[model samples]
Target: MTHATGYAALSAESPMAPFTFERRALRADDVRLDIRYCGVCHFDLHQARDDWHNSVCPCVPGHEIIGTVTEVGPDVTRFQIGDLAAIGCMVDSCMACPECVRGPEQYCVKRSTPTYNGKDRMDGSPTYGGYSDHIVAREQFVLKLPEGLDPERAAPLLCAGITTWSPLRHWKVGPGSRVAVAGLGGLGHMGVKLAVGLGAEVTVVTTSPAKSADALALGAH
Candidate 1:
């Protein structure tokens, strides 16, 4: 086990505080990364507050993670030391399942192993997230961070970018498509950017008209 430190919520109502825990030793086919940035997802707050009633105590919440590979287990081949990588909402999944075979490991029939607040498939250890300084995950779940992208700005893309892109892509939004994004917050702003990038005429519907300028700046119609 490896010692790790991060801020965690000891209970549903407790504010996050410095907490110490242990991470499992690397296994074959594993990649260990030194976390550079971890995006704050809405779900992180939900879990930290036990909103869904499934949170584990001393919960460390973060999923939109960006990092550089520091070590690789013997059998790992897709990455090596010094490579930039990322892990989204999932750490593992049963690849043979229907949801995984078709596409979207996030919908794995057996339930994808979440980056945090979930149990490891093998040893059943509580999965800790990227709120810590480091994380270890199977090579399959770790994605390569593309070159030329700003690592800081790109951190949110792991979650926000994909969350919007997937739906638009699945629906086949294109040049003539009409898209309307509600709200101008994190996810909604990304929705506008992606929809417009795909050539859709995007309309951002927000409660405050003051956000109109920001929406247009993000490329919404």
Candidate 2:
């Protein structure tokens, strides 16, 4: 086991505190990453305060992560020793589940394992998140970083980008589709960009009139 440095809460109502924990030993199917950057998602704030009452501490809060692959399991093939790999809001899925087999893991029928503040499938240990120095996860949940994507800015894409991508893709928002994104923060911004890029007429619907210019600058009309 290797020790990791992270920010976590000791209980549901607590603010995050500096903490340390051990990374599980690498499994033959696992890839180890030296986490360099992690994005702060609203979910992290919610879970840290136990907004859902499911908070189990010490809750390490993060999922959007960017890092270098320092080690790979003997059985891993898609990644090598120095790949720029990423982990999103997911860590594992029940392989036997239908969605897992189909690659839409966000819909894993057995409930896809979350990246952090989740329970490990095998050890039952609480899965701490990426506000840390290292993480180990199944290769299925690891995404390869495309070139020129900044590690810091790119972290959020692992979650925000795909969440928006799915809906546009599912609805087939091609030419002539009218897409209106309700919010411009995080997920919503990604939604607008993806929809517009896919040839839809993207309208960023925002109550914050101040951000209107920013949205339009991002290619929304």
Candidate 3:
């Protein structure tokens, strides 16, 4: 077990406060990371506040995480100590399901294990999250941070960035494609940036005219 410290909500009405806990011991396929940055996703807020009515007490909420690899289990091969790494909302899934085999682990026949406010598939222990000093995740769920990317800025890419990037890629948005983003919030701004990068003509549709400059600066039309 590894001692970890982070902020946690003790109850639905409680604000997050400093809490100490233990991270599970390394499993053969697990990777340990020294967390460097964690992006605040609104989902984290919902979970912390028990807005979904299912949040467990001592909820440590964060998912968009960037860290430096500090250790890897014996069977791990994808990362090495000192490598920049990340973890998204998912930590594990049943790997034999058709959905998992095809790469969409989120749809695993057995529900995917969330980063926090979830139970560990192996021991049913409550899972904590990335708003901490470090974390342990299965090798399969860890991501390699690209060499030149800024780790601090890349944290949100695990959540908001990929959330938008997936649909854009699925639709094959590219040169000559017209993409209209509906809002200029976290996800929308990321969508605009990604679509523009994919060579699409991007447009921002928002009720707030005050955000026009912000939208255009993000490469929207």
Highest-lDDT candidate: 3
Residue 209 lDDT, candidate 2, scale 0-100: 99
**Scored by CA lDDT, what does every candidate get?**
0.91, 0.89, 0.95
lDDT of candidate 2 over 93-207, digit per residue (tens): 8888887888777788878888877888898888988988899999988989999888878988877887899889899999999999998998998888888899988888888
Worst 10 residues of 3 by lDDT: 7-16
TM-scores of all candidate predictions against the true structure: 0.96, 0.95, 0.99
Residue 127's C-alpha lDDT in candidate 3?
92
Encode model 3's per-residue lDDT on 54-112: one tens digit a residue: 99999999999999999999999999999999999999999999999999999999999
lDDT at residue 171 of model 1 (Cα atoms): 99
Candidate 2, number of clashes? 0
Q: Stretches of candidate 2 above 4 Å error?
A: none
State each candidate's clash count.
0, 0, 0
Q: For residues 1-221, what per-residue lDDT tens digits would candidate 1 score against the true structure?
A: 78999889999999999989999899998899899999998989999999999999889999999999998999998998999999998899998998899877888989999999999999999998989999999899999988898888888888898989989999999999999998999899999988998999999988999999999899987
With a 3 Å backbone cut-off (N, CA, C), the pairs that clash in candidate 3 are: none
Task: Name the 10 consecutive residues with the lowest summed lDDT in model 2.
Answer: 8-17
User: TM-score of the candidate numbered 1?
Assistant: 0.96
Clashing pairs in 2: none
